[model samples]
Target: MRVLVIGTSGYVGSAVAQRLSAAGHQVVALIRPDRGKRARRYEWRIGDLTDPDSLTAAVTGDIDAVIHAGTPTGDATVDATAVAALTSRLRGTGRTFVYTSGVWVLGATGTATADENSPVNPIPIVGCRPDIESQVLDFAGVGIRTAVIRPGIVHGHGGGIPALLVDLARKHGAPVVVANASVRWPMVHVDDLAALFGVVIEQAPAGTIWHGVSENAVPVRELAIAAGQAAGVGGEPQVWPLSQAQAELGASFADALALDQSVSGHAARDRLGWRTEHPDAVPDLREGSYR
Candidate 1:
């Protein structure tokens, strides 16, 4: 398969690129010219989706699958515009287009071990989700294999939000966790998430919605303590109201930190034969090592 990965140089895209290439697929990474020289064995195409010509060049035929991982900033409408352009061009091509959405779109609901069918709680940022997923899924209706992957808080090695928190812990000497870290956030390993992307593109039903999560949910406080331990920082988590978290970390990031979102990965496992290698998300944080 000739896979053209949009935004293929970032964290998740890079991981997915490695996964597909290791599986014996030829990978074409569509990256910004700024990523400098390309890595070995992979083909590189310099382009930005903001420009139609560049985007077309990125996805021109001979591309068998597309991992739509690029998220343009500045406007929600612009994000939709980017997705619409790619889906419009790729419709009926029999190519698989994988769209990455976050589990945050399910919003805040008491954990019922929600799966792909959970009701969505709309945050301002995630409001674009339904529209975006709908557009991609519509491609399946037009004969393209379109799949949407709703990823949880992914962590592994230098990736994951927890590791990023470790960076913050190192800088601030102690991390301030919102509401005592008990707010459940779903999480997965970066490689596991990338593997699920491979599964979806290859096996998921055309209109299926997949989840890239391993554990059902881990408490935020537990996650915080682990990050602190990994960073060799020590301090009891500072409990604060949601308002305080918003004030401390910008409100958008605060919503993520404070959201008690638990999502189920059962559907992906059952339907796509996607199994997560890492069953636990806290061991690395708990012991200060990802090994």
Candidate 2:
């Protein structure tokens, strides 16, 4: 399959592009014209998610599938328009269209673990995602093999949110946990999430939704301690007041970090045999990647 992947230079998309290429799919990276060339492993197409004409131009010519792992342009209308532009070209072609979403859509799952079947209560950071997800899934009815993957807080490869924790530890002389110590996060390694993308792009039925999580819930305090270890500041993590964190990281993003969620990815594992390689993120935070 000739797969056109957006956001190929990003942490998640880079890993996804590599996995797809390793799986013998011809990977075409849709990059913004300003970003110039990327790794030669992918065939590059000049495009931008905010530009419909660029997106339309990039989706043409023997492309078998599209995986949109790009960062949102922060405008709901633009994001929806981009999806329309991409899927419109693939309509009636039966080509795959995978949209990247996040677990935050199933907000604050407290005790009961949320799954793919759970109702969405999105936080402000991703308030518009559910609607865009619906737009993408609706394409399945028009002969496009459209699917949505909602990944958990991504960590690994010395990057992502965990790295931010390490950076915070270094900056403050202690690791920081937003809100309270009980906040938990669902997580997935970048590579593992990428492999799931490979599987979904090839085998998932139209309109399917997959949760790309591995660890159902990891306590943020535990992660902070590990991050402290990585930062050479081995001590108890400091709990930042929500107000303080909100002042720094903004309310929506800080609230998202403080949210407690236990999200299950068992659907992908049970149905698609999408096993995760890096199940435990603690070691990755302490001595593996972030270290």
Candidate 3:
């Protein structure tokens, strides 16, 4: 399949593009002009998602599918505008469009594990996503094969959400959390999540929703210990009051971090045979690249 992957320079995008290429797909990376010196590995197309013209041009010509993994810049309008533009271009095109959402959209699931059918109660930062996801899914009825992927906390290679804890561990000799230490975070390896993109692009039907989570849930305190140990801190995790966390990391992110969630990816595993090779995230965070 000929695939167009946006956000090629980002952590998730780079991994997804590489995995698709390794899987023998003709991967075209849509990169920003400022991040020059294009990678020679895949066919590179320069464009910005926020720019309607660039998004239209990027979707034009011949392309089998598009993976919209690019992240928002904290401005919901910019993200919504991009989705509107992309949906407009792909409407009635009979092409595959994979949109990236996150498990945070399910909000605090408490003890219950969220599934594909779970209701979305997004946090403040991603509050705009439910509406945008609806808009993208609407294209499925208009001849576009649209799929929404809700990934859990993506952790690997000492990057992603774990990096925040690791950085704090290095600075303060312990990992930190907001308000409560028992909040649960669902996690997925970057490589495993990338593989799901390949499966959905090739086999998913229109309006499919896939959760790219491996571990159903892990406590913030446990992750903090792992992060601190990996960073050579090896101490009890520190707690930040919600107000302090909000002041430091912004209310949206702080509230998101405090959410207790457990999510299942059984649909992806059963439907597409996605088996996570790196499921034990604590060990990885403590001894692997993050160490």
Candidate 4:
């Protein structure tokens, strides 16, 4: 399969493009015109998500599938338009289209675990994402093999949000938790999430949604402590009041970090044989990548 992948310059998309190439698929990475022409294992095509013409031009007929793992442009209309432009070119071609969304769309799940079928209560940080998801899934009806993957807080390779905890610990002499000590987040290692993307691209039924979480609910306080260990700091993590965090990190993003959610990815495991090689994120933060 000749797969055209957007966002290859990003963390998740880079991992995904590598996995697809290793699995014997030809990967054509869509990148910005201004990006350096560094040699990569996969093919490169000039494009940008904000520019619909570039997106349309990049999806030539030889491409068998597309995985949209790009960061949103922060404008709902532009993002939606980008999706439309990409999918419109693939309409009636029976090519696959996979959109990357995040678990934050489920918002605060409290005690009960949310699944792919759970109703979405998105936080403000992901405003209009659910609507965009709906738009992508609707393409399945028009002969496009469209699917959506909602990944958990992605961590690994010494990057992502966990690195922030380590940075904060090094700066403040202690780790910091955004809200109360008990707030939780679902998580997935970047490589493991990439494997799931490969599976969905090859075998998912049209219009299906999958949760790419490995651990359903990891306590943020514990993660902060682990981050502190990685940073050579000691004692419990300091709690940053939500208001204070919002003032620094912006209200919507801070509120998202404080949300307590437990999301299950068992559907992918049971149905697609997607096993998570890295089961615990705490160790990765304390002794693995973040260290």
lDDT tens digits by residue: candidate 3, 215-289: 999888988889888888887789978998889888888888898999999999998888889746788788887
Ranking by lDDT: 4, 2, 3, 1
Error of 3 at 198 (Å): 0.6
**Ranked by TM-score, top first:** 4, 2, 3, 1
What's the true lDDT of residue 276 in model 1?
86
- TM-scores of the models, in the order given: 0.92, 0.97, 0.95, 0.98
C-alpha lDDT values of all predictions: 0.77, 0.92, 0.87, 0.92
Error of 3 at 235 (Å): 2.5
Q: How many backbone clashes does every candidate have?
A: 3, 0, 0, 0
Worst 10 contiguous positions by lDDT, candidate 2 = 33-42
Candidate no. 2 TM-score: 0.97
For model 4, what is the alpha-carbon lDDT of residue 104? 92
**Tens digits of per-residue lDDT for model 1, 144-168:** 8899998888887666577767776
Off by over 4 Å in 1: 34-41, 288-291
Best candidate per lDDT, number?
4
Q: Which runs of model 3 end up more than 4 angstroms from their true locations? A: 37-39
**Residue range 109-187, candidate 2, lDDT tens digits:** 9779999999999999999999999999999999999999999999988999889899889999998899899899999
Q: Looking at candidate 3, what is the lDDT of residue 76?
A: 77
Output the lDDT of residue 66, model 3: 92
- lDDT, candidate 3, at 241: 89
